[model samples]
Target: MAEAGEGRYEIASVISRSFETVRSNLGLFAGLALILSGVPAFALNLWQTSFGVNLNAAQPDFSALLSAAYLGPLFVGWLVAMVTNAVLQASLTRATVTHLSGEKPVFAQCLTVGVSMILPMIGIGILLALGVGLAMLLLIVPGIILWLCWSVVVPVYVQEKVGVIEAFGRSMALTEGSRWRIFLTMLLVLVGLWLLSIPVGLLTVAVAATGSVIAVSLVTAIVSALGSMVMVTVQSCVYVELRNVKEGVAPADLEAIFA
Candidate 1:
């Protein structure tokens, strides 16, 4: 809703709407996030802590860290984390879209959609990670640019039911005229999250010092879940706003697609 020109969205509007969506659907978002992200994170943290690996120590025991026992669970945990995150993203997108359309988002429906889209979402996630990660290795600018372009790929895939490659193309097209604003929006959100994490990080360290790995991991998992909820909701909001600006598609129109 910027008057600057067609296909341009307001940064403040997107940010405000994103937070409002999360606030309004607090219970739903938190529940999905805890189930999808928090549990897995806690399990992974417990596994890591059990190894008694002091990664923070100077000249730590690389041999113990690189052993099969450590590396195997680490890989599996990472894989699970990735898949769960994809599901969470898809579910949150569904919920956010439904809410925007003035319909009450059903938790079961959102979760079903998320589960059904898991394979493609995972594929898209992998491709995005590889493409952006390689770009970052070459130059930071290109990575950031690619991230901005493909930021809404998951939502596009979820809503449009497109092939993985097509989702990337559609997202790039939707984000074409609004990358600058999108970049600023992302920067502000990230900065705010970083500032908020300061206290949470301190609390984490304090808990770790108490020799209570379970407590520390629980706190960490909760924080991660909340962070994921906010970020995923923001992504959904961005996708909704971009479609409105570029394609003139209203939330009601999108809602009917699911009907």
Candidate 2:
């Protein structure tokens, strides 16, 4: 934990501290995940089950899936997911900041932080998504490069309270010499998440076999929420480590932002 706020972090220490954060504050992380991801995921899953449609299918049977009945719930679920994701990111950023500063994060206080930053956070997220999507449209490599380059934008925006444009610049600056490290960090996190999902995937399959939509939805939602929480924790840690190493930003400086 001490290493998390110090001079430099190897990839291993960053990951270790992230897990420690989650372990030490399981209730806070779980509650945030439930509010931000579990409910929306469950709602979406339930809606899809009720509609008897898979909006996520590679080759969806549009004849039935394109109807008003299907589109209505689909749109609602999408909106819910989008809004909740924005909230989750903001909440996680705030909570992680507070935790790293060695303070107990109050749920309401964290929520307030999230609410305050939701607009700018969501705006930047949308812009980044559009930028990545456009790059992907042009070429796959460019999209991946852009994603890596802008990886720390969210944490920068939250911690620095910069505008979206400045946040992008700040992220690029912090990630300058460490883009490869960030890539490896992302890769490791993804691999870990995939491994974590295996058990949940099996559970989903088993539940699906029973033809109980609610059960399947509930299990899937829980798994998705857990994954989201872990990823956010790791991401926040990565941002802090990067700032510490790149700009010599002390932990006290970080805490002072909130103070």
| Candidate models: Cα lDDT each | 0.89, 0.83
Q: Write the per-residue lDDT of candidate 2 for residues 1-259, one digit (tens) a residue.
A: 2234334547987788788888888999899999889999998888788876566889877788778888887888887788788888888877887788788878888888787887787788799999999999999989988887888888888888788999998887777767777778879999988987887788889999999999998998988898889888888888888877866875547888645
Clashing pairs in 2: none
| Candidate closest to the true structure, highest TM-score | 1
Q: Across residues 97-191, which tens digit of lDDT does each residue of candidate 1 receive?
A: 88988878888999998998888889998999999999999999999999999999988888888889999999988888788889988889989
Off by over 4 Å in 2: 1-9, 54-61
> Per-candidate TM vs. native?
0.95, 0.91
Model 1 segments beyond 4 Å from truth?
A: 1-7
How far off is residue 28 in model 1, in Å?
0.7
Worst 10 residues of 2 by lDDT: 1-10
State the local distance difference test value for candidate 1. Answer: 0.89
